[model samples]
Target: MNHVAPPGWPEQVRPPDAPEWERTAVGWLLDQCPPEYRGHTVLRRHPVALARLTAWHVEACQAGARRGLAEARTALRDALPMDAVEATIAALLTEQARLEGVRRAAGLVEVALRGRRFPARLPGLGSRHE
Candidate 1:
């Protein structure tokens, strides 16, 4: 997946530049999110939710990288009743997975079409000098 850093995001996740307002955090997180989730209005309306979600995302990313994806997924799920941001991220991830599946299917179709148009040569199926 393409990862474009949000404008005004601190160089790192912690210290020095962490935002005080949940609204700010929400904006920052949205910037980092996929195009589909970037415009979600629920995040804008709920500051507390946004804050919790952002915190969870930061923790999950750090932990996932250090430990493993399964651990990260479990950790987030364990934080149940997730905030808007967390729920949004989860939804976005699911959407991303769905999109990836569609992309793969399209690629397979393309390969099949190409193969039909230009069949590959077999090494010994129809040898001329057998």
Candidate 2:
């Protein structure tokens, strides 16, 4: 049977019921994480574990982005041109948005890895797991 992933699912990952979906999920999760995470054999072998780690990593990245946005002006204005400082702030804002999306996608993948399936729900029906 065909399956449909819910909104916020990463496009790089196949639906949870697809063939070798776990492998794709693992690959996508690892891509979100730092290179050192690839060295963990257990995480490579376990999709759920990798998903959890990816979630944590994404959370840390989001926090870093927030801190950078908060300090961008005060920290860089003195050392850099005003234009450069503004660019830095803009970059941080963009990163914050990107990280938020990644965070949601990672959470969805983690839920799928835990045996929760997101079939296509009816219009106006909201979300359901099976």
Candidate 3:
């Protein structure tokens, strides 16, 4: 059977075949760090920090989605509380807005290290390797 993504879901879900490290935020961060700085203690530790932040952000997003879904369900059963529904929608919108920023920040360290500007659009993020 074919799987269908829900409306507003991200176009790409997690890749089933990706390696464990490639599937994680810390690993992605570490892979993005500049080759020269990879040996530096601070740089080596950066991924761990980023991973923690990503985890928290993801949790917030998940919570927001859940709240929004519940609110929508409640609306179907009774008079919608517009305030609560709006708040939940706002939270989900905030999550979508911040995702790009997180992606950019994850690559900023490496871009700065390489003396290259971080593009408004992340280009060549995955192809970079020491």
| Number of residue pairs clashing in candidate 3, backbone atoms closer than 3 angstroms, sequence gap of 3 or more or interchain | 0
Q: Please count the clashing residue pairs in each candidate, in the order shown.
A: 0, 0, 0
Instruction: Give lDDT for model 1.
Output: 0.42
lDDT on C-alpha atoms for all candidate structures = 0.42, 0.86, 0.44
lDDT of 3 by residue, 10-37 (tens): 2222221233322343445544333454
Off by over 4 Å in 1: 1-25, 32-36, 68-130
* Residue-wise C-alpha lDDT for candidate 2, range 1-130, written one tens digit per residue: 7576887788888888888878889999999999999899999888888899899999999999999988888988889999999998898899989999999999999998898977678865653332
Which parts of model 2 are misplaced by more than 4 Å? 122-130
Candidate 2's TM-score reads 0.91
Task: Return the top candidate by lDDT.
Answer: 2
User: Candidate 3, residue 37: CA error in Å?
Assistant: 22
| lDDT, candidate 1, 1-130, per-residue tens | 1222222223322211223423444455454444576566876676445444544554454444445333545666656555744765666667555444433423322232233222223554431111
Q: Against the hidden true structure, what lDDT does model 3 obtain?
A: 0.44
TM-score of 3: 0.31
**Alpha-carbon deviation at 67 in model 3, angstroms:** 8.5
Better of 1 and 2 by TM-score: 2
Candidate 3 regions with alpha-carbon error over 4 angstroms: 1-80, 110-130
TM-score of each: 0.31, 0.91, 0.31
